[model samples]
Target: MSERPYVLLSCAASIDGYIDDNTDERLLLSNDEDFDRVDEVRASCDAIMVGANTIRRDNPRLLVRAQQRREDRVNRGLPETPIKVTFTSRGDLDPQAQFFAAGDIEKIVFCASSAVDKCRDRLSGVATVVDAGNPVDLTAVLAELAARGSDD
Candidate 1:
């Protein structure tokens, strides 16, 4: 197989090619049918990732909504929910966000070396914080995820 985990980027955009309208309220880009499709995709993956901006903006739980899907993962010897990941430069994240509080699965945070101490202090009980060099290296993050058995 490959040295790194297979990465899949999933998102929805409007017909006008806009992701959001810069509103305080969250936008609904996908309908119920498409949301079910996304749930299926989440069930198949070992992990799911978003940036700090996404967490700050959307505050998503990133959990498997279908009970059966969560059960299927447990039957397959995996966590009920996929591992959640996020990367940040300044490490400005709320400890009480849904991303940290809503799931029983592992949460990994990649941050710049300079921000490691502060990030760890803030997210100490909430996530596993890793320093990814001065600028937060994506390559290192991927390798670390692969090592943790995240094949997706």
Candidate 2:
């Protein structure tokens, strides 16, 4: 079998191990320097993934933000940003969310088998909705992503 893509899990949390607090607004867990570092990491990746809840709550653009970095990627024959990916059991994602709306690159949604049609219907123009098994098998999802050439 072909090798699966390398998975790099990146996150920021408070000293108490909380990524966020109970608030309507999203918490700022990282400073500007930290954000710049993450942007560099994102630039090096083949795809960037977030949970559906993050899309709902944080509404992040999930793009490599620096203009020069974007140009560099394009000059390398890559997209301005990497593919955007998300997984959900409920498939309750907003097509208008920045995850879907911001990038010119591909957007992929891996949903529970039961939610596939719903996600496909809801995210038709926004993302490529995939059935990642009934409970959303993460291993299979990663294999599929590797097959699609997201090796980083």
Backbone clashes in candidate 2 total 0
What are the per-residue Cα lDDT tens digits for candidate 1 across 24-79?
98999999999999999999999999999989988999999999999999999999
Error of 2 at 73 (Å): 1.0
lDDT score, candidate 1, position 33: 99
Query: Which tens-of-lDDT digit does each residue in 1-152 have in candidate 2?
Result: 35678999998999999978888898999999999999999999899989999999989999999999999999999998999999999999999999999989899999999989988999998899999998999999999999999988
- TM-score of decoy 2: 0.95
Report the Cα lDDT for candidate 2: 0.93
Stretches of candidate 1 off by over 4 Å are none
Off by over 4 Å in 2: none
Alpha-carbon deviation at 32 in model 1, angstroms: 0.5
